[model samples]
Target: MSKTDHPHTHQTHAAIIKRLKRAEGHLRSIVAMIENERACVDIAQQLHAVEKAVCQAKRTLIQDHIDHCLEDSVGALGRGERVPLDEFKQITKYL
Candidate 1:
């Protein structure tokens, strides 16, 4: 989706990108730390940050799917537009 749709869209995208960029830096630092044999605590914290970033991205994707995909599905079904009910049901099942 375009960034102009809704505030949630832009905000979520921004959060996701920022998290990934930070995680990228963290990954580089992780490699350096590994080479230097840094403390395990610091490494673990960086790993957790990566995990959180992944989850945040997942949540944002799910939100967009719900907002756009489900909305389109519902509208199509309501209008009896040619979208097969069984197929739509399967699609909605994922949501």
Candidate 2:
């Protein structure tokens, strides 16, 4: 299924987009700093910030996907409908 088809209703997709855009801006600033021969320390600091922002966005997206899609979808498996162990293990890879 397409990404949008996933059940992420509880998480605001716009918030994720905003975060990614912010990270993209930070990355652009870093590139400019490098081209200008900015101080190594200053460049490193900004790079770190950009990395953290991207990582946070990734973590948020994965958590939201698991919380809304995996949990909700698997929950529909009624009584006696066993979820495969392999499927559960695969899903946990994100965590």
Candidate 3:
């Protein structure tokens, strides 16, 4: 399966990347806003939106890894494959 299918690891990386690029643009706008002395609440709201987007992307990636990669590996191990245990252990760090 594809990386995005991994649920926890999987994400539309390209999509998230594009989104992050947009966020960067938003950051530049925020910077401009600061230079222009925009209202604190407006800046804060923009910042919060950026944060939310990033967190959402992260969550999507994590879910992809879990759903696809981890689930498949776990299933394989259950079927008597000897791999995936270490990977499973490694994933715990993210927890």
Most accurate candidate by lDDT: 3
How good is model 3 by TM-score?
Answer: 0.67
Tell me which of candidates 1 and 2 scores higher on lDDT. Answer: 2
Instruction: Give me the runs in candidate 2 sitting further than 4 Å from their true place.
Output: 1-10, 76-91
- Model 1 regions more than 4 Å off: 1-11, 79-95
Each prediction's total of clashing residue pairs, residues at least 3 apart in sequence or on different chains, is 0, 0, 16
lDDT ranking, best first:
3, 2, 1
* Model 3 residue 39 distance off true place after TM-score fit, in angstroms: 0.6
Candidate 2: Cα lDDT at 17:
86
How many pairs of residues in model 2 come into backbone collision?
0
Whole-model Cα lDDT per candidate? 0.69, 0.72, 0.75
User: Residue-wise lDDT of candidate 2 within 21-80, one digit each (tens)?
Assistant: 998999999999999999999999999998888778778876776666665446655434
Instruction: Score candidate 1 by TM-score against the native.
Output: 0.63
Q: List model 3 lDDT by residue over 1-95, tens digit each.
A: 74322333234777788888888898889999999999999999999988877878777666666666777788888998755666666665764
Tens-digit lDDT string for candidate 1 (1-95): 44223333444677778877888888888889889999999998988888777777767766765665666667777998655445445445544
Misplaced by over 4 Å in model 3 are 1-11, 75-95
lDDT of 2 at 46: 93
